[model samples]
Target: MQKPSIPKGTRDFGPAQVARRQHIFNVIRRTFESFGYAPLETPTLENLSVLTGKYGDEGDQLLFKVLNSGDFAKDVTAADLETGSKALLPKVAEKGLRYDLTVPFARYVAMNRGTLTFPFKRYQMQPVWRADRPQRGRYREFYQCDADVVGTDSLLCEAEIVLMMAQVLNGLGLDDFTIKINHRAILDDIHQAVGGVVGQEGSLYVAIDKLDKIGRDGVTQELLARGFSKSAIDRLFELLSVKGTYLEKIHALSEHIRLSIGTDYTGYTDLREVYDILQASGFKQFDRLEFDPTLARGLSYYTGCIFEVKINNVQMGSVSGGGRYDNLTGSFGLPGVSGVGFSFGVDRLYDCLEALDLFTSTAETPTRCLLTHFDAASGRAALPLLAELRAAGIPSELYPDASKLQKQFKYADAKGIPLVIIMGPEEAAAGVVKIKIMQTGVERVLPVGEVVAALTVE
Candidate 1:
């Protein structure tokens, strides 16, 4: 028989792992809600039409398409098969697993535009699939915790996103991180100044976005391979190499863009305003905010400011990222609606937490107290006590099989259950029960009715 196995780039979380993951989710969810973002969810599978062309060429190539139900190839001709997967994909697959929550959210906004309020704010925590090669800190299937606000062009929204990012990361016990900020328009200006091809701006953005991963030489090689002029690549790096504080770098870029384009640099100004807003609001973590000239989030829809976050001293990729999209809804026939958002990489964050040994001791199992018995009669006698404990909102469980005291204690210890209740025949006759604190090994004899109150108080 073939060995059973899960797909590569995916994971099966056991109970303890699930509990730890849930802890991460809970923090993100609570933070998103506290910022006045309502919870929203979209379907796992979205129609190909809705998914295609939204995330640019590279992102589109990473999409995981789902084939049509039976006879997916029944309508395809021999010529279609020979044309390659690209030509045949549409013929066989009409839908695909969502690449990310943001696009599906845009579709949702468009479909419900008439009924919903403007500037709809929502948070979504869901799994998305991709077809890319998976590696460390990168998965084919993973969860993204996102919060977005559509239908507004407020820089305050951008500032709030920065604040929320800091809050969530700090809440999760990660304080040393940087929230890199940039502008797509500024990237465009750099492209134009560097004599980048008019219609090939995406190439520049995609190449520059990998600056952190591949280093300067690598990005330059990619830019040259993509047909960028050597002088152009040098000029692009000249602007990207500017170093200083956030405001200082912003000023330098403004002067460069203004001198090169002979026009006011709105992107730089907007970026400055975001920083100023955060400063004015007394954001204490200004040290964590940075103005990155080369941070072009490769996603095509981002038309305004962009953000990416990296944790310090950890060997991992970005744990969170997102940006402002001016008119993502325009593709869905709802034009002129703007939005800004960010997403936390839950799986990566979990890995970082585990590596750093930051996860606190959380319950591996929900059962707080296990009722032990020596025989079937003793077990039956413990039933009433179990019900009472549960009724009092204490997580209590009964040892189903009559077992030795040592065996029961071992089971409770293995599960991290803290308390064990013993109700043997002798205790039953005495109208009392013994409660053992598993961690302390201290036993207390209490009346049957006092068990619930004692557990509750403890």
Candidate 2:
């Protein structure tokens, strides 16, 4: 017999855990709805073509490929054997588990472009799978609470997303976080400043994005391993240190850029435009917003401003991340339309809550009151009162078995049940009841209406 074990990087959430997770999802979903976003859901499995080549090379490798249902081995070809066609393997194995919400969302918009409204607002709460290593605050199977606005290039989308993120986290009772903002164009300007390569965007950004995880020294080591020059590295370092008001970074870059590239290109000036717009929109109060130049989300599709949110004093991975994609849907022949969105890593967030002890009190008592059934007849007698308590908006559970009174009381006590309404033979015959305070274990005989009025959380 095979030992019962799940694949690595996956998880199984028990009942209480599901409740807490659902609570979090409800907060997010409700907040998204309040912001005029409609809910959207995609299938768990999508055509491999739709998912492939969308999340950059690293992401493509992390997709969980599905095998063809019938006799895939026989479909092998001689030319396929020569080149080792991982890309073409999907033709044999035609479907894949979705890698992320954003890509599938792009596919959806493209397929439904005729029907979708411009600046189509959508909120999707679903489980996304990644075939990656499982570690602290990361998982193979977890939920990405994503809200996106597609078919618009307005940075107003950025501000609204920032506001949405602030609202969601604030509603979750987490006020301590920093939303680090950066622009791909600004990074592009810096990249152009030193040894610009046409297709090096993904490789460059992925390395820079690791700066937080690996530190400056680690980033330099990784870039060197990726073949960056000394002069290029120095210039990129100067580019990264750009901070303060957006104008300051642009000005500083303007001055030092020529040192490496021999011409100070005025590319990052547009970012200052973005900053001015945000500043005018009163964006400063938007949840500890900070200018971080190192935010390079590994997705290739992001074509503009990018942001990441991190909790202060918490040593976890990014709790949320995303940015703009100017032409993602264009890949499917829908040209020039743009979209921007962000994803909240719910699994990492639950860990953050646990690490900070924020959820210490979230393991709510299952029932506020337990309807104690004294015996077979009394159990039968107690059902109406149980129905009445529940009808009165009380969360009450009936102990189905007519167990020993001690055992029933112990069940109520073990569940942290604050109150237990007992219908014993004498009480049932007299049309009275015994309401015991499980916390204090004190019993009081009371009328039925009195029991309902008493259990209200005063």
Q: Report the number of the highest-TM-score candidate.
A: 1
Best by lDDT: 1
lDDT of each: 0.91, 0.80
lDDT of 1: 0.91
- The residue ranges of model 1 lying beyond 4 angstroms of the native Cα positions read none
**What is candidate 1's lDDT per residue for 237-288, written digit by digit as tens?**
9989888999999888878877887556788889889988998988999889
lDDT of 2 at 204: 81
What TM-score should be assigned to candidate 2?
0.90
Give me the overall lDDT of model 2.
0.80
